[model samples]
Target: MQAVIIAALVIGIPLAIYCVCTVKREEIFEEGSGKNAEVLDDDGKITKETTMGRIIKMDKGMGEFLMANGLHCVTCTSSANESLADACIVHGLDADIMLSKIQKYLDENA
Candidate 1:
């Protein structure tokens, strides 16, 4: 019984530590390569289908607006996969209103 417990601890502790390290590494890579290096469409317009990461990549300043609107996951890995419409749905926000605001901001800034 003691041997089993020791073996379990030995295996489990290393496994847990490895998982944590792996996650941190992936986060670092995602932050550097995934978020900052993403390319925007040639038109550079914010549409419902535009991913949050692409929006931020197009204009980092947009992140502030998104956060203010309670869509603060702009920096998260999931943002790379999530579109404005999906994010708005998940956050209980009106997608049309958000898209309009985003386009207005882009127009003014451009």
Candidate 2:
């Protein structure tokens, strides 16, 4: 029936797109999977060089940490290119303290 066909398409198309995006994200971001991959190191902590967008995408806990630290710019346009240190500087936060907290959180959760 026409209704069945429409329902199938409505559900199927987005599901297909979601699958594709998920695969691509894994391929691109998985440790050493691609050039400039956003990977956790042997210590399982993000480096100061890690970008805010990568943190938001790869680790929700770190993203939450950023949010709690007053870097609400996590979702802002400039976040894509901003490192943790850069964000801390922009927000007038202590990068060393934030990094230590983040590292401790990752260690405990790991």
Candidate 3:
């Protein structure tokens, strides 16, 4: 019926668009990326793992965590903007060594 067709068009279009977008997004990237990818440091150590649709997050509040690993993130206002490797360099530490430990902690606790 004309009414049925109108109703279907209104509801079905959005659903169809959503499905298309989802499929296209998936097809563009390999599976196990995005929420499923395991992040690693320069040393090839596992830094964080995704869980229940979330990647394990790091905290910058812990001075010990930052300094012990030689990140120097605790001092720099730009630290939040820096990546692990950059943070290590700014702090005058070996990024590979520091990141290896950070990755190890993240993996063990994650």
Give model 1's TM-score versus the native structure: 0.59
lDDT of 1 at 52: 71
Least well predicted 10-residue stretch by lDDT in candidate 2: 28-37
Instruction: Please provide TM-scores, in order, for all candidate models, with all chains considered together.
Output: 0.59, 0.56, 0.41
The number of the candidate with the highest TM-score is: 1
Candidate 2 whole-model C-alpha lDDT, 0 to 1: 0.65
Highest lDDT, which number?
1
Deviation from native of the Cα of residue 86 in model 1, angstroms: 0.4
TM-score of 3: 0.41
- Tens-digit lDDT track of model 1 for 39-91: 44556555688877566655546666677878866645556678989998988
Off by over 4 Å in 3: 1-56, 59-63
For 50-79, candidate 3 gives per-residue lDDT tens digits of: 121111133222344554555434433323
Question: CA RMSD for every model?
Answer: 7.5, 9.2, 15.1
